[model samples]
Target: MSSPNELPPAIFLDPWLTAEGDGLKALSQTIAERVERQISSNLSQSARRDAISRRGLVVENLVANLAIMHLSPHLENRDLLAVATAKTKATRYDREDYPKRLLSGVVLAMEELGLLIRHPYAFRERSTTVAPTPDFAATIDRQRVKLSDIGRALGAETIWLNARTGEISFADRTPLKCRIEYQDTEETILLRDQMERINAYLNQSGFRFDGEHQGPVCLRRMFLLRSLSDPHSFNLSGRLFGGWWQELRSDRRHRITIGGERITDLDFQGAFCQLMYVHLTGKPFPGDPYAIEGLEDHRGGAKLAMLTLLSRRGDLKRLSPELKAALPRGWTAKRLMDAFTRHHPALRDAIGKDYGVELMATESRIMVELLLTLKARGIGAMPLHDGVQCAASSGGLVAEAMQEVTERVLSVALPVVEKPVVGQEWGYKEAA
Candidate 1:
């Protein structure tokens, strides 16, 4: 067994380790020089504040980028920074100053080194509040701005607009703006097209876009159903899944087991699934799929099967009258796959295998192509992994569809593995 000091093979590929290492080295030197100069000169309070502020800005920006990279597809700049700040603050680091500020400075330095993309929205100033109102009657004609208006102006879907002040508050809060270009290639164009189709499918199924939810309606409930139905445990521990093991070890947020065997609360798999869904649907997920722990039993294979059924073209004709009646209008196989994979690691891996796992170009193309197939078929399946499925509906259609899709996909993906019948008295058995 390798010692704790021994670096895993995946360490070389970790961007966080490389960036953080370089950042810490530079930060240490800079802090040392600054502190020495401060001591020698007896710097004024204002000067000290300025110095800290500058450092804070840098750290905030660094944390922002880290959050962006980790929380892609769904997380915007402001939200990313907020999450990063909260995460960093929860760690065992020194608390002499606002950790958010320090982390922002680190982020800024990293950006200067071209190690991260500076998200533009991170720095944009939200509209300011001029005054506060005493009561509803007094503020009735005060021209309260709706959240939608603010979101539209900022091109942000998830934002809290204060009705009285017209100030927009970001959930993933950070106050730093950096212009970063999202390179648009053929793949991005295709993904956009897929998003349009998915939107249409939802509309046809009588599921209106609820911006307040920040994702598809009833997405959380559908996810719950998927988790309940899944036979295999979605182990965050690395032992059960090899490639994911080393990556978890390097993440400072959660500790991996001493033997490099387990991880806790690292939700990259679910995050990837949500990212794929957003790419294909242009809708944010309602909640983090990785938040789910443990498992429940209640088969939803039939629902999953329906999702697979809808994903394919010309398959609609194959459905029996009873099946057709049970299925939601405009349901498609592609949408089912999209929703299933949002929390289904196996399906996510399968897609990665099919497309090649490069995030920017290759995988993006595969997701777009898959989405296009669903669009062509007029199916309303949302993007998900292999073992799960989901869709937006007014009532029980979401649950029903998920159950149907799960069964179909599992039967095909996880065929029966037979064990030889052992003698009643035999303690050990040998493979035939």
Candidate 2:
């Protein structure tokens, strides 16, 4: 066993184990034997081991399900392996070899079979860093099918991946549409079932990717599923952070339609800023949370600054050259901060004081409540971080749900900004 300060030994990964190589059956037996040894009770060890072995199989099944349905098919098999073999975050590495005990043997076995690939460095890559040539790259599609069969044997009933293309049904086997370019992690696997459930629900509830847009409606798709994650503290607010919608052009979003009726976007004006002000002052945000008294011309910067402050726990550096070039004149980070402080003195003083995590938690709770409420009403709604969208006729219900959750959780009702459907004029007024 290594000391607490020492790093865990590197383990090469192969998430999709080959049938001829270190196969699933051998891996299962190994896990069972290891788990059995961990059982310390004097009670009939064989019987207890058998029961625990069944549960371990269930966990293995779940992992396979995640790989087939939720994990991005665009990623190389080695990347997924990296997630499973990644280092532990727990502090008791001095005494316990939890992660290594679970993975090291399987990794070595796979390495011997020529199916494993070690990361270039000790740590896992955040994105698809490997560009394996054809000779070195394993058949990802074949591996997916093999994993799916494993899942099926373990009782997973969903058939989301195509047999040949290895694509999820949500994007209709379209390349790159369902690709998860992010790093492989346990959290990524944990989110797969929820994503599958939601995608299944959307398909069952009459949601379709309308193909009338200039881009592939599938690629230019508007996925309504929550990533269940965010950089601002990993909140589950149904934020479109990683979805294709975030990549959609603003002019083209209005083209999203459901059942032949045009869909409209409903925004929450200065959402995070308003939430922070309300949380701190116990009073509604004074009109236009983004409009600072001294920076009226730089509403964009004021909004951006407010977001930057509320979303993180850190000091504000004056705008970098890259950031400065992206914004209009007079919109430096320093100027924006000054304006933000002037307009909302109490809230400004509270920025970057370790308040972001709680705010995110609160926001996530409220969004989950709203989404559940809408789901119960049989009205399909797409979350937009701060607000959600349904049919315009069902707009009132969506608004009511948003307000209810906000008030119930925050004890205040912030403004809800609604955008009208194209060729119509019925959205909430934009904050001046």
Candidate 3:
């Protein structure tokens, strides 16, 4: 086996293909032999062999990508199909119905190796139907051990595994040059250094949370320690919209802690509405932005309905299933929109305006300043959509920084919504 000290093939650029290509070839050949043996006699031996080899080649290319998903468990089938099609140059993958066929094949191969188990992933933000295996890291560690033996026999370093996170980085230089549409060139270059710095900070300061939390929940929580995209600023709005933080289930958000201090979440009240009101009228709303005239009892439903209608530009016919499901039983999208419009006339008029984009940019500016200010003071903080979380002891400091940033960016004073202190009474403290 290549020693840990031996540098991996520098050709990780293609990731699916490596400088020492013999190892992948050997692995594919072994899988093909197994698949060929299992084929029914309905196909002739030569035909069966050819089919198995084709399927095996696809499987060999996908192994590394699947292994890397240990860190980002929410990858959808469509995204995987895009990657597979690009990597294998398989024309069949471009078909409209290709995702189901290709993903099922990949799932079957991984299951045969006891590498993955499918779970129902029903997040409102995700359109995909399946979740990555919760045990992806453990499974990949076993594969890495097995592949180490295979590498010893082959006498080459074809696999590049990060033992710490079970993240598999590609060592093939060729395939990586293919362009992806959403690739942010600047963030892509800085990602590695960002991870290293975050890792060092977390390891040195120690991250602590409640022990009663389930393992998978805790795994998601750990995403705060590493970011997938640029953290220097927000994605579109003042909010940091991308990465593991945005995907974390709301109930589990309060579990994060640092240096024995409980973390508290603080956000602006009626975030978008207040911002929009300020933008149009040059003043914040006097009361609840979500308060409907006679339908005050349905504030929560009213708020959601208004946001949905505004976001879709009052296209009630094409309202998403999730939005439709959020309303009361008898309420249709059109009915909800009519009710919200009657009560919020000014907001209704403001709909289809360019204010939302402006709101996001303003909020993003506030967040950038907050983050930079905290970083300058050597304080650790995390961003939620309209709020910031930090060690409970630093709550006052974080709040002051946030207010200062908001006023500086918007030329207005914004209201704050402080979430109750978390992990304080539970006898949990940051690790010493």
User: Clashes in each model (backbone N, CA, C under 3 Å)?
Assistant: 64, 0, 14
Query: What's the TM-score of each model vs. the native?
Result: 0.22, 0.51, 0.53
- Global lDDT for candidate 2? 0.47
lDDT of 1 at 46: 90
Worst 10 residues of 1 by lDDT: 217-226
lDDT of 2 by residue, 1-432 (tens): 222223333222323221222344454445445544544446576876655555454334323423332223223232333334345453311113123344544434333444344333333223111222232233334343333234222112121111112333332222222212234347534444444444444434433234331111111111221222322223322232323344445555565555555565666666777777777788677787776766566566566566567654456666645445545676666775776787788886787665554555566556656756676678776665666656666776677677777788788766676765455556544322
RMSD of each: 23.1, 13.8, 14.3
The model with the greater TM-score, 1 or 3, is 3
**TM-score, prediction 2:** 0.51
Better of 2 and 3 by TM-score: 3
- How far does residue 423 in candidate 1 sit from its true spot (Å)? 42
Error of 3 at 337 (Å): 3.7
> What is the Cα-based TM-score of model 3?
0.53
Give candidate 1's error at residue 76 in angstroms.
19
Model 3 C-alpha lDDT per residue in residues 1-432, reported as the tens digit of each score: 223223211111112321123443454455545544543457677976666655665555444334333323223122222232123333311322223234455545554654444322224211222222545445445444222122111111111111112243243111111211132347433532343343333334333444221111110001121123324222333234323334555565566565666677777777778777777787777877777654466666666665555543334554455555655666665676677677666777777543454566566556656666776677777666577767777777777777677778778777776765533343222221
